[model samples]
Target: MPARPDRQSLPYRDCVGIAVFNQQGDVFIGRRKAEGDPEQSAELGAPWQMPQGGIDKGEDPLKAALRELHEETSISAVSLLAEAPEWIYYDLPDDALGIALKGKYRGQRQRWFAFAFTGKDDDIDVLNPGGGKHPAEFDAWRWEKLGRLPSLIVPFKRDAYDKVVEAFADIPRRFNLG
Candidate 1:
């Protein structure tokens, strides 16, 4: 199999995105499936979230952001209605994440991008990870109201997701999309 452009490098710190809405006002959320969080998935008995992942050495943050979004959520960058300019970051707790990444930057610097879902939830393909090693990034998916999402995500990721959600609030608000 060929490697995706996002996988051209290794161990880069870049995973982030803005969860956006579909035409009907539902927010897109990709459940990280069972692979990303064994403990969380087993514990909560639920799995889903916004698509996100690390960046390649030379990839632009937006490129990386869009890449992750598709690889995880199956939503292409072309589907995005708005993408953020500046990058936002968050550190992983000592108890979470790989050891190599834990001690260094503490967290990754991420650029968040927003999309307008052009297709329905059935369009998302969590099992088809494209160039990804794991076939599951999301087990189930759906679009919720943007206002309620910050609370729906896992606690550890909530803060980071919340920051981007808050920072990008103007997208739907300004456009009055939802």
Candidate 2:
């Protein structure tokens, strides 16, 4: 059998993730659109995920998070609440090793941000780009309880989601929104 590639030989792509919370303390979650997914089949096992995307070459992670949020959900009425103190990473599953992310990355090293949604719910428009170069990532979206996040995303990404949940679990208390 061929020797397995070491992690160092497979660098992760730098990425950003967003957790947008509404006044009711619910967080935004989107149903990933698989229509033209290059890496996933039409029926990706996990259909739901939070807004996330790769950070541009020189873009700040926070900026990427906000941009991704708007690009994916058309919601720009958010204010930063907190940024994770450290970056966290997750490896792509074997099935995705050579097919996902254009095979340039082994997985993702992400910086997560929590933001409070200041606009009304009507601000969300997943099907239309409020103003973005990239196409939409989600076909539909809705507010969801933070605790339920991990279970909603792909298995390979669950741990990353769990870490995000832990990192921002104090949001309600810290922001006095609960």
Candidate 3:
């Protein structure tokens, strides 16, 4: 029998994450769909998360962030606020090593972007995201405080979320976004 490859030996997937903040300084988050297994659910942790996804080959990071934000939330009325100065990364837990991320990546190396929501609440929709061209990644959605994001995400992803929060910490006051 062949030996299994070390999890750390796998490459990290290139990805982008978007945080959309409203006038109240709250950020958009969506409740992820349950993966349909009790054990998997426990391994995945909290369901709520900001919009994020893998980046396509040869795609610009900012472009990928906008596309993913629209694809996952059906939100388009937004103005760029800030982009993280560096990529943030997180690794999947051992139990999820070969199961999550299509078993191809050990984790994600993400570029994060913060945007100000410029449209009404009605403009946001999790169902029929991207006008149904993309499958829904979230089952429900809500606005949450920026600092609360790290706690709301899965354990393996908290570090990345924390870094994102830190990177954009000055946005609200700098932009007078309340």
Which scores higher on lDDT, 2 or 3? 3
Residue range with the least summed lDDT across 10 consecutive positions in model 3: 35-44
What is the TM-score ranking, best to worst? 3, 2, 1
Q: Give the TM-score of candidate 3.
A: 0.93
Which scores higher on TM-score, 1 or 2?
2
lDDT of 3 at 36: 61
> What lDDT is obtained when candidate 3 is compared to the true structure?
0.88
The TM-score of predicted model 1 comes to 0.73
How accurate locally is residue 104 in candidate 3, as Cα lDDT from 0 to 100? 82
After TM-score superposition, the amount by which residue 114's alpha carbon in candidate 1 deviates from its true location, in angstroms, is 0.8
For model 2, how does the per-residue alpha-carbon lDDT over 1-178 read when each residue is reduced to its tens digit? 4444554678899999899988888898988878767454554477888888899999989889988888888888889999998998999877667567886788999999999999988878888766555587788888999999998887888899889999999898789876
Question: Tens digits of per-residue lDDT for model 1 on 60-94?
Answer: 76677667777776665346566666677665544
**Deviation (Å) of 172 in candidate 1:** 2.4
List the RMSD of every prediction in angstroms. Answer: 7.4, 2.6, 2.2
- Residue-level error in angstroms, candidate 3, position 171: 0.7
Deviation from native of the Cα of residue 136 in model 2, angstroms: 1.7
